[model samples]
Target: MNYSIKVTGLKYTMTIISATELQKNRIKKLVDLLKQCENINQQIENLME
Candidate 1:
């Protein structure tokens, strides 16, 4: 099974995917990790600007 999670921010958006059942059960952790990734991406964008 495939699970899609959408995380949206003021200047960025991301889609997280889980391809395994084990990962599906860790959605909350995945979301948190995605949030961290989004923050890092935002910081990179800021540095580039």
Candidate 2:
């Protein structure tokens, strides 16, 4: 019974860790997209000038 409880706890911890990692990856992607957008905007401004 104790062994089963330990296994359940470990699985729960792993799920939480993976969820956070997924969120981090999503945030990184968003940041990269923002940077790309900024670069595009700068190029547009230069073209207009």
lDDT values, one for every candidate: 0.60, 0.49
| Candidate 1 minimal-lDDT segment of 10 residues | 5-14
Model 1, global lDDT = 0.60
Give a tens-digit lDDT track for model 2, residues 1-49: 0111122123211122344667767756655665566667777879999
Clashing residue pair totals per candidate (backbone < 3 A): 0, 0
Tell how far residue 4 is off in model 2, in angstroms.
Answer: 45
Please give, for residues 1-49, the per-residue lDDT of candidate 1 as tens digits: 3334434444333344544666555765766787788778778889999
TM-score for each candidate, following the candidate numbering: 0.49, 0.60
> Which consecutive 10 residues in model 2 have the weakest lDDT in total?
1-10
Candidate 1: where are CA atoms >4 Å away?
1-25
Model 2 residue runs over 4 Å out of place are 1-19
Best by TM-score: 2
